[model samples]
Target: MEMNLVIVGLVFVVLGYLVGVKKFTWLLAGYNEKRVKDKNKLALLVGGTFALLGIGIAISGFAGIQQAETIMFVAIGIILLELVYVNVKMVE
Candidate 1:
C-alpha cells in the first residue's frame, strides 16, 4: 500500500508539472484566442485533477487497500469519459 502511494505521488508530481508549468499558460492563452482550438486545457485540468487524486490516494492508501479502489475508480472514470469523447469526435 505504501509503495502504491509512493508511485501515485511520483506520477502526480510529474502531472502537476505538466499542468502547472509545461502546458499551463498555453491553456489560458487558448481562452484568449478567437479561432476554435483543441486546447491542452483539458489535459491541464485532467492532469491537475489526477494529481489531487494521487494525493488523496496516497492519503487513503495509508489507511487500507479498500480506500485505493475508490480513488482508482474516480481516475478511471475520468479517463473513460475522455476516451469516449475522443472516440466520438473521431467518428465525426
Candidate 2:
C-alpha cells in the first residue's frame, strides 16, 4: 500500500490543532471530560509542537527534502508520548 506522506502529515496537523485546542478529548474512550478539560501546559505545548512538526514534515515532503521520513517518525513518537503525557497530567 502506497501512502502519501503529505496526507499523513496533514492528518497529524489536524490532530495537533484539535488536541491543542482541547477538541480531541472526545476521542479518548472512558476518559473523564473534566480531567481532560483541565488546563494542562504540557499537553498544550506538546500539541503545538506536534502541529509545527507536522507542517514542517508536510513542507519537506513536497520539497523533496532529505530525511523527511525521519522527521515524520520523530513526530509520530512525540505524539505517542504526548498521549501518555496528557493522560498522566489529567489524572494528576
Candidate 3:
C-alpha cells in the first residue's frame, strides 16, 4: 500500500470538507473575494473536485495500484480543466 498517497489523500479530504462544508474560502490559493461571482458555487466546485480526487487517490493507494502515475496525471488534468473553467466563468 502507498502510505504517502493515502496521507495526501486524507489531507485533501480534510481541506475539501473545510472549504465545502465549513465555508473556508480562504483556503483556496489565488482566490479573490471580490472577483468571484458566486462564493458558494466556487466552494462547491473546487471542494467537490478535491474530495472526489482524494477519494480516488486513497482507494488507488489502498488497492496498491501500479498505475499511480496515470492517476496523478488524470488528477492534474482535472485540476487544470477546473482552473480554466473557474477563471473563465466564475471570476469577474
lDDT of each: 0.59, 0.67, 0.89
**Residue 48 lDDT, candidate 3, scale 0-100:** 91
User: What are the per-residue Cα lDDT tens digits for candidate 2 across 1-92?
Assistant: 11366776687688778767775645444556565546455446656876787787777778766675677678768768867877776655
Task: Please identify model 2 stretches exceeding 4 Å from their true place.
Answer: 1-3, 28-30, 34-43, 66-69
Q: For residues 1-92, write the lDDT of model 3, one tens digit per residue.
A: 98877887788789889888888999999988999999999999998989999998898889888787788899889989999999999999
Model 1 — which ten-residue stretch has the worst lDDT?
27-36
Q: Which candidate tops lDDT?
A: 3
Candidate RMSDs in Å, in order, are 6.3, 3.9, 1.0
Question: What lDDT score goes with residue 41 in model 1?
Answer: 51
Descending-TM-score candidate ranking: 3, 2, 1
Q: The CA-based lDDT of model 3 is what?
A: 0.89
lDDT, ranked from best to worst: 3, 2, 1
Top-TM-score structure, candidate number:
3
